[model samples]
Target: MRPEAEPAMKPVFAKIGKPVAAKFRPDPFQLASLEAIRDADCLVMAPTGSGKTWIAEEAIRSVFQKGGRCWYASPLKALTNAKWVEFGNHFDPANVGIVTGDTKENTDAPIIVGTTEILRNQLYDAMHSGENLNCDLVILDEAHFLGDLDRGVVWEEIMIYLP
Candidate 1:
């Protein structure tokens, strides 16, 4: 297909960039997402700037508060880097870590932000080794990519294996 014949791509700007609200209020969908997360796995789908990241932050915060671990997987390494910084700022720099194809740091931190491929690879290793992923909260950002022709399998595998 010609370049212009292909579908236009959505810009991967950070949705976690909104300025802090003085008295932030959760929208209904945000509330619903949080409610669902408390019991079992949750997949939050919403328009850009609709507080999905806030739901993720809140979920991570809940696990952090309990001294549990979290795995945040982004579809791209760059977005993984952004979440690393954003999470570090929100939950203390010492608690957040980054792992991508080229960089790995603070792997022992309670909150881990990395590419989906790394997370998927970790799950595979865990499965082969008969070990479970030591994470309490698992957030898969850019989950819409599960429809992608190439990288969707990574997302599908992670979802299937994550307990």
Candidate 2:
């Protein structure tokens, strides 16, 4: 049997020589919301810049840390591009990828940022082609689009047919 690789050590001290750590200083509502969505899918309905992205970050981090892949889907190409840049900063670029109607990079990456239709099409392809599994968790970031007249079908397809 092949042996496992050794884990890399995280720097105990920051560049300034102080201990590096995460501070749990989220606001009351943020804390409550984080706790509420820790284990299940959430329907966050908050104003923009109210830290809704933080919840998505936490969920993505949780999945990635567990040695699993996360597929974050958006309704708009602009949002997909924005999320690609945002998540690329957090995860390694090689491990992070983007896919949309016009953009596709690192399609096999662990963390994928894509439009809902792109993901749906990928899922459909995977099923029809019988490819190996690729994703573990999928976060529909702007999930309220199920009410939209033009694009709701794509999101519904993803939610209904994802493996």
lDDT of 1 by residue, 1-163 (tens): 6444223332333444667769878998898899899999888999999899999999999989999999999988888989999999999989999999999999999999999999999999999999999999999999999999998999999989997
Top candidate by TM-score: 1
* For model 2, the run of ten residues with the poorest summed lDDT: 7-16
Q: After superposition, how far is residue 95 of candidate 1 from its true place, in Å?
A: 0.1
Candidate 2 wrong stretches, greater than 4 Å: 1-24, 32-38, 130-133
Instruction: Give TM-scores for every candidate, taking all chains together and pairing residue i with residue i.
Output: 0.85, 0.75
Model 2 residue 150 lDDT score: 93
The C-alpha stretches of model 1 lying farther than 4 A from their native spots are: 1-21
Query: What is the lDDT for 18 in model 1?
Result: 67
